[model samples]
Target: MKATVDPGRCQGHARCWDISPEVFDLDEEGHGTVLVAEVPAEHEEAALRAAQNCPERAITVA
Candidate 1:
């Protein structure tokens, strides 16, 4: 699986990072950034959780 963050839609809520810090990272302003372009199998669950937990729905997972 892979995850991506939409910088334009993100509002620095940090929920994604809070759910899965291993897969999502936060910028200085607390907006999420994708830590890995391709998520490892072991982290796919966390990645999906992070995407779902994002209040802004700025995260995409596939």
Candidate 2:
């Protein structure tokens, strides 16, 4: 699976980082960054949760 974050929509809620810090990263300004564009088999669940948890709905997973 692949994940994308829309910078324009992100409000730096850090929900993704809270769900999976290894998969998501936060910049100094508190914006979220997708550390891995593609989710590994083991991390699929976490990635999905992170995306779902995004209050701004900035994360998209496919």
Candidate 3:
């Protein structure tokens, strides 16, 4: 699965990072950023959870 974050929608809640720091990161301004877009099969679950935990619905997994 691949993960993506829409910066325009992110409010820097950091829920994504809280759920999966390995897959998600935050900029100095506290915006969600995707550290790894294409998640490995083993990490797909974590990645999906992070996406789901985003309060702003800024994260998308494909």
lDDT, candidates in the order shown: 0.88, 0.89, 0.88
The global Cα lDDT (0 to 1) of model 1 is 0.88
Query: Which numbered prediction scores highest in TM-score against the true structure?
Result: 2
Clashing pairs in 1: none
Please, what is the TM-score per model?
0.91, 0.92, 0.91
RMSD of 1: 0.9
State the TM-score for model 3: 0.91
TM-score of candidate 1 against the unseen true structure: 0.91
RMSD of 3: 0.9
Better of 2 and 3 by TM-score: 2
lDDT tens digits by residue: candidate 1, 1-62: 88999999999998888888888899988888988878899889988888888888899999
Model 1: CA > 4 A from native: none
Error of 1 at 16 (Å): 0.9
Please give, for residues 1-62, the per-residue lDDT of candidate 3 as tens digits: 88899999999999988888888899999998988758888778988998888888999989
Q: Which 10 residues in a row give candidate 1 its minimum summed lDDT?
A: 47-56
